[model samples]
Target chain A: MLNTEALAGVRYRENDVRVFEELVRRYDRKLYNVALRLTGNPDEAKDLAQEALLRAYRGFSRFQLGTSFEKWLFRIASNLYIDRLRKQRNVRFESLDEPVPTASGQVEKALPDWSNNPEDVAEQNELADEIQAALQSLPINYRLAVILYDLEGFSYEEISGILRCSIGTVRSRIHRGRRLLREKLAPYVKPAAAAGARW
Target chain B: MTCEKAMSLMSAYLDKELGFDEFRQVELHLAYCEACSQEYESLKATKELLGTLRAADLPREFWPELRERLGAVAAEERVAPARAKFASSARQSSSRQPRWRGILRPASGGGGGSLFSSPMAKALVPAFLVLVLAALPMVWSTRRRPAEAQVSSRIDSIEPYFRDYVISEYDRPLSDKTSVGFVVTGQAVTMYTSDLLGPSSKVTRASGLREASPLPPNTAGNEYTLISYPR
Candidate 1:
C-alpha cells in the first residue's frame, strides 16, 4: 500500500482524482469524529467534515510533502469551524444565577452527584453526554486544546502546530481546560477514584 | 514550589510534558501538600473520564455527498482557467493601454488611436461620462461622511470583491487576544484583523494599487463582523 506521502505526491504531480479519493477515505472517519465532537451536532459535523475535505483537495498544492497529513487536514478543519463560529456569533450563554425548575422545587442549577452509581452501560452513555456538555461549555480555544489532547490523543506539539500556537499556549489552554472540566465533573471523578482507576 | 505554581503545573505534570527539574519540583510539592495532591488527582480523573467517551463512526452519507461536491468543484476548476484566458486575451486585443491613458491621449498612436476609433469605444465613452457625472454627488456625499463610517462600509462591501479569490485564514493568538490574517490566493490582496471576535479594524491591500489603513485602535473591538454574499 502507498503511504500518505506517496499518495499525496502522486495526486499533486499527476492530478489523479483516484489518489485523492483514497487519501480522503483514509482520514474520513477521524475527521468526521473530530467535527462531530467540535460541533456537537451530527448534521453540522458531516457538513464541516465534507467542507474540510473539499478544501484540502482545492489547496492540495500548498500542502508540503513529508509532513503529517493529519495535522495539515486538521488545521483546515479547525479554521473552518472557528470561521463558522465567528460568522454566526453563536456564543452559548448560561447564567449561573438562574434557578432550575426541578420536580421538588426551584433550585440552583448545579452538577448532579453521580458518585454512587455503578458504571453500567446506560450510566456510561449518560456520562458521555454529560462530558460532551461540559466540553461545549468551555471557550473554543480551551475546548480545542482539551479535545485534541485528551480525546484525540494528539501530542502537545502536534496540537500546537494544528492550532497555530506555541507550546506554552497549548500548555496553558490544556491546564485551564482540565481544571474547568474537573470542577464540572467533580461528582463523577470521586466515584471513579474510589473505584481504583489510575489516571 | 508554591501551591499556586504546583496547581498550575498539575496538568503538565500528569501529562508528563514538564522538563526534569520542573517535573521534580511539582512531584516534590505534591508529595507533601495534601490539597495539591488531591487537585492533581482530580485533574487526572477528569482526563481519564474523557478517555471513556467513544468516538462515533462517520455516517454513511458523508462520502457520497463529498464525492458529489468534489466532482462539481473539479468540473468548475477545469472550466475556470479557459474562461479566464479568453477574457484576458479579449481584453488585451481591445486596448493595451490603461483606461486613463487612453482617455487622456486619444490621439496617441500606441493602442489609443484604434481604441477611440472602435465602435464599441465610441458608444462606451458616452456611457462612461454619464456614469461619472451621475456618481459625482454620491461620491461627494460619501466623502463628506466620517472616515470611520467609510471604513465600516468598505469592510461591509468586501464580500463582492472576494468572489474570484480563494481565501485562506491564519489565526494567531496574541498574549490576551486573537488576531486573524486572511491570505487571498489568485488575487494580490491580503487582509488582517487585529481581533477575531470583536469589532476589529482590518487592513486590506489590493495588489498595492490601493491600500486601506488600519482604523484607530480605540474604535476597534475584538469582534469581526463577517460579510456574506450569495454566489
Candidate 2:
C-alpha cells in the first residue's frame, strides 16, 4: 500500500516536486491506455493523457491522502475523455434501426469474403481483425467497461470510480459487451475441420 | 438463492466483496446450476483475455512534459504561502508606516490614489490590532504588575504567622466553606485551591464571576494552580 499520509504530507507541506513527478510517471502509462481505449485514437489519447496529468497536478492539493490516488487520477482522465466525446456529438453510430454504415453512411458496406477460397477466408487469421472491428463498433459505454475490466484488469470498484457508475453497471456493461463480441464473432468462429487450414 | 440472483452477485463473489451470508447463498446456488457456472466461466475468461491487452507505453519524453507541467504547478503552490505573506506584509506597511507611502507612491504610479481611501482605512483598524498582538505578553504583564505585587506582598507577610496554622487548616477536610483566596490582576483573577504552603494558582472563566463560588462549573479559561498550602 502506498503510504498515503506520508505522500500527502510531503505533497501538501513539502510541496515535493519529485513526488509529483513520480506520481505522473507512475500513472501516465495506465492513464494513456485508458485514454487510448476510450478515444479509440492514439493522438487523442496522448492529448487527453497529458491534459489529465496537468489536471491532476493542479488538483493534487485537494486530493485526500491514503485513499485511491489511482482512482482519482483515472476519474480525471475518464471525465476528460467523456467531455471530449460530448463535444464531438456528431459521432454517429449505426442506430439499431439503421443499416451498418461502412466508414461513412454513404460508403457501400463490404461483406466479409466467405467463398471458402482459402486465401480469402484466411482461416483463423480474420478472428483478431473481426474482434477489433466489433470492439470499435461497440457503444462507447460498453466499450469503456469492456476495455477497463478486460484489458486493464481494473476491479469493478475501480471501474465504477473511473466510469462514475455503480459496480452493478460496470458488471452489466462488461457482461453485455462480451455477449455482443461473442455474437459479432459468431460467424468467424471456425469449425474444427476449418481450423486445420494454414493462415 | 436462485441462479438469477446468484448470477447477479457473481462479480462481487469473484471479487470477494460479497458478505458471508451472500457468499453462502451464491455458493449453494452455483453448486446446483451448470448454466450459471458456464456463464461465470465465460465472464472470467473474457476478463482474462481482456487483461492481455498490454497498455502501450508512450515515448519516453511524454512523462517528462507532464512532469514539467506538474513541477510548474508545484512551484506555484510553494510560492502561494510566501505570496500571501508578502501581500499581508505590504498591506501592513501601507497602513502602519506613513513613510512607506513615499516608496509605494512611485511604484504604484497612478494606483496610489485609493491607498488610504474610505472602507480600506476603516478595515485597517482590525489589521492594526492584529499587529499589536505581537506585544500581548508585555501589555498583559504591565497591566497585571500592581495587583500581582500586592498578592505577592500579602503572601509574604501572612506566611510566617500561618506556617503551622496553614498546615493545620489544610488538614481541615476539602469543604465548601474553605474560602479560596484570589487576587485580581488586570482582567484576570488568580485563585488557589488551598493557598500558599502549596503552590500559586489561577481560576479563570469567561462568564465573569457568576460561577466563581468555591465550586467551579465547566467554563473556558478556568484553570487552577495550587499556590501554597500547609504540608
Candidate 3:
C-alpha cells in the first residue's frame, strides 16, 4: 500500500481520482468520528465530514507534498468546523434564549440536562453520553485541544499545527481541558476505576 | 515540586511528553502526595473512559452517497473550464457590441462556435433575452446611482481618513468600476479591493497605516489586510 504522502503525490501529479478515492476511504471513518465527537450530532458530523472531504478535494492542488497529509486534512476540517461555529453562534445564542412554544403555553427554555446521578451512569452507553455531554460543554478551543490530543491521538506538535497554535498553548489547553473533564465526570470516575484498571 | 506545579504537569506526565527531570519531579511528587496521586489517577481514569467510548461507524451507504457526490463535483469541475471559455469569449465579443448581442452572436457563429452550435443554445437565446430585458431597468438605475451615495452612516466618521475614496462595507463598484470596500471595526481596518489591487498588495508604512497581519485565506474570496492606523 502506498503511504499517504505518496498517494497524495500520485493524486496531485496524475490527477488520479482513484488515488483520491483511496485517501477518502482511509480517512472518512476517522474524520466522521472526530466530527461526531466535536459536534455531538450525527447528522452534523456526517455533513461536516463530507464537506471536509469535498473541501480537501477542491484544495488538493494547494497541498504541499512530503508534508503530513493527515495534519493538512485535519487543519482544513478544524477550520471549517470553526467557521461553522462562528456562523452559527448568533443563531445558537438566540435559540437558547428564546421561549419554545409548547402545547400548554410558551415557557422559558431549559438548558440541556447534563447532571446524571452516579447510579444512572453505570451503563457504558450512558457513560459515553455523559462523557460526550461533558466534552460538548467545554469551550470550543479547549474542546478541540482535548479531542485532538486525547481522542484523536494527535501529537502535541501535530495538534499545534492543526489548531494553528503554539505547542505551549496546546499543552495548556490539553491540561486545562482534562481537568475540566475530570471535574464533570468525577461521579463516575472512581466507580469505573474500581471496576477494572484498563489503562 | 509543589502540588500545584506537579498537578499542572500531570497531563504531560501521563502522556510521556515531559522532559526527564520534569517527569522525575512529577513521579516523585505523585508517589508521596496522596492528593496529587489521586488527582493523577482521576485524570488518567477520565482519559481511559474517553477511550472506552467506541467510535460510531458511518452508515453503510455513506461511501456510496459520498462517491455519488464526488462524481457530481467532478462533473461540475469538468464543465467549469468550458463555462469559463464561453464566458471569456462572450466578454471579448461584448467589448465590441452590447452584452446581450454578444451572447446571441455565439448562435450566429461569432465566438465559442462549438459551445453555441448545440440545440440547447438555440433555445436559450430568446429566454436569456427576455430575462435580460426584464432586468435591464434595475441594472440601469443602479449604474446611474453615485458610487458614494449609499455609503453607510457609520462610515461617515472615518470619511476624513480617505476623503478621496468612497468607503462602504457593502459590495459596490468604485467610480472606476472596481469593487472596493474597507471595513473599520474598532481599531482594525480590513480592506477588500477586487480588481483594484492584487492579492499580494501590501500596505506601505508611508500610507499612515500599520499592517498587522494577513487574515487566514478565505476560500471563497481574495485575501485582504487587517491593518490599523495611528490615530
Candidate 4:
C-alpha cells in the first residue's frame, strides 16, 4: 500500500541515513522515557535507548515495513534492559503465567477473594511517586513484564517477543510483579469508604 | 474455579491474555466474589495511577546532547567500514603474492652475484626485510587504534569483526587454459566488528568463508588483531 510509515520504514531499510534522524527524533523521547523508567537511572536509560537505536539501525534491513516499528524498537530496547537485568542476578526468575499445580496438587491463587477500599489511594501525584517506588522494588523480570503490560499496554504476544520468553512466562511475571507492587504500595492506599466501592 | 484459581487468573483477566474458558471463569467469579472484585479494582487503579508518571522533564541539555552524540556516532559509522575495507584489501594484496620463496631462499645456498653472494649481504637483506614486515603491523595498528576506538567507543555498538579472509589472484597466459598460481595460508588473524561501526561494515564484511573466523577471542583494541589480517 505504500503508506507513509511504511515508506519511512523502507527508507530506513535502504540505508537512507538521513531518514535515521527522523526516526530517532520521532522515537527517542518516548523510548528514552520508557528506558529511564525501566532502568531507574536517567543516564543509563539514555545509553540504553541509544544502544537500541544503534542496533535497530544496523538491523533495519531485516525489519519488514508492514509490522509495527514501535514494537520492534521496544523489543530491542526492552530486551537490552532485560539482558542487563538478567546479568545483575538481582531479578529472581519466576513461573509461567499459567495456572499450575504443585507436587502437592495445590494451585496457588486458586481461590481468590480479598479486597478492601482503595479509591482513596492517595492523590494522583502522591500515588505516582509511590507506584514508581513500588515498581523499583520488584525484581527486573516482574517489573519489566508488569510495566510493559500495564503502563505501556503491550499484548502478551508482543511482550513475549520483547522478553524472548513463552507467553505463559509473561503472564506469570506480570501477575507476580503486580503482586509485589501492590504489597509495596498497599500502605499508601486508603481504607474503603463503602463495602461496594469495589475499586 | 476456586477463589485461588480466580485470583491466579486475575492478571490474565486484566491483560486479556487468558483463554475464553479461563476468562469467563474469572469474570463469572468476580461478579459473585466481593473480595476478588475489589482486588481487581485496586489492581486496575494501580495500572491507571502509573499512567500519570509520564515522561520525565528532560533537561534542555538532553536532546542537544543526544543529537551531538548521534552525529558523532553517525560520522564514525560512515568511516569505520571504509577503513576496515581498505585494511582488508591491503592485507589481501599482500597475501596474494607468494611467501614460500621468502622462507626457502632465506636458508638456501642461492648465494650468487644475483643477490646473495656474501654472507653479510645475504643475512642483512633478509634480516632488514624481516624487521620491516614484523614492525609493519605494529606501526599500522598503533596509527589505526585511536580511530577504530572512536567509532565503537560503546561496547555493544556494532563493531565489525573480520576473520579468516582468503584473497586470490592468478596470472595466466591467454594460451593456457589451466589455473597457474594460488596461495593459501592457515595462520591469519580474524577480526569481528559489529556492523554499526561504519556505513557498510556489515555489507562490506567478507563472509561465507569455509571456516568460522577463529579470530582473537577478546575485541579490546580491535586494531591490533585486525592489522595482522593484512600480513
Top candidate, metric DockQ = 1
Residue runs of model 1 more than 4 Å from their true location after superposition: A1-15, A90-124, A191-199, B90-231
TM-score of every model? 0.58, 0.51, 0.58, 0.54
Candidate 3 TM-score over all chains jointly: 0.58
Candidate 1 lDDT over residue span A154-190, tens digit each = 8899999999999889999999999898888877885
Model 2 agreement with the true structure over B1-231: per-residue lDDT tens digits? 887787777656655656799988877776667776665655455444445455677857676676677677778878997899999999987778677565434344445454454466768967999879978998998998897667756665664444444334544566322334443323455554342222233322221121234534325544332233333
Q: What is the lDDT of residue B77 in candidate 2?
A: 76
For DockQ, candidate 2 versus 4, the one ahead is 2
- Candidate 1 CAPRI level: acceptable
TM-score of 4: 0.54
Off by over 4 Å in 2: A9-15, A90-144, A160-170, A185-199, B10-38, B71-231
For residues B1-231, what per-residue lDDT tens digits would candidate 1 score against the true structure? 999999888898889999999999998897778788778878888998999989899898887888889877777766787799999999897677666775545574545374566678789989999999999999997887686556656765784354223122212222333333343322233554334334353324332111233422323343232332212
State how far residue B94 of model 3 sits from its true place (Å).
Answer: 11
lDDT of 1: 0.74
Highest lDDT: give the candidate number: 1
Q: Say which docking band candidate 4 falls in.
A: incorrect
Select the stronger candidate by DockQ from 1 and 3.
Answer: 1
DockQ of each candidate relative to the true complex: 0.32, 0.20, 0.24, 0.17
For model 1 the TM-score comes to 0.58
Clashing pairs in 1: B197-B222, B197-B223, B198-B222, B198-B223, B198-B224, B199-B223
Report the C-alpha lDDT of model 3 over B1-231, residue by residue, as the tens digit.
999999889888889888899999988887778787777788888888788888798877677777777777767777787799999999887687855564444455465564456788779978999999999999987885564334333365554454233322112343442444454433346664434444366444243222233444444434232222221
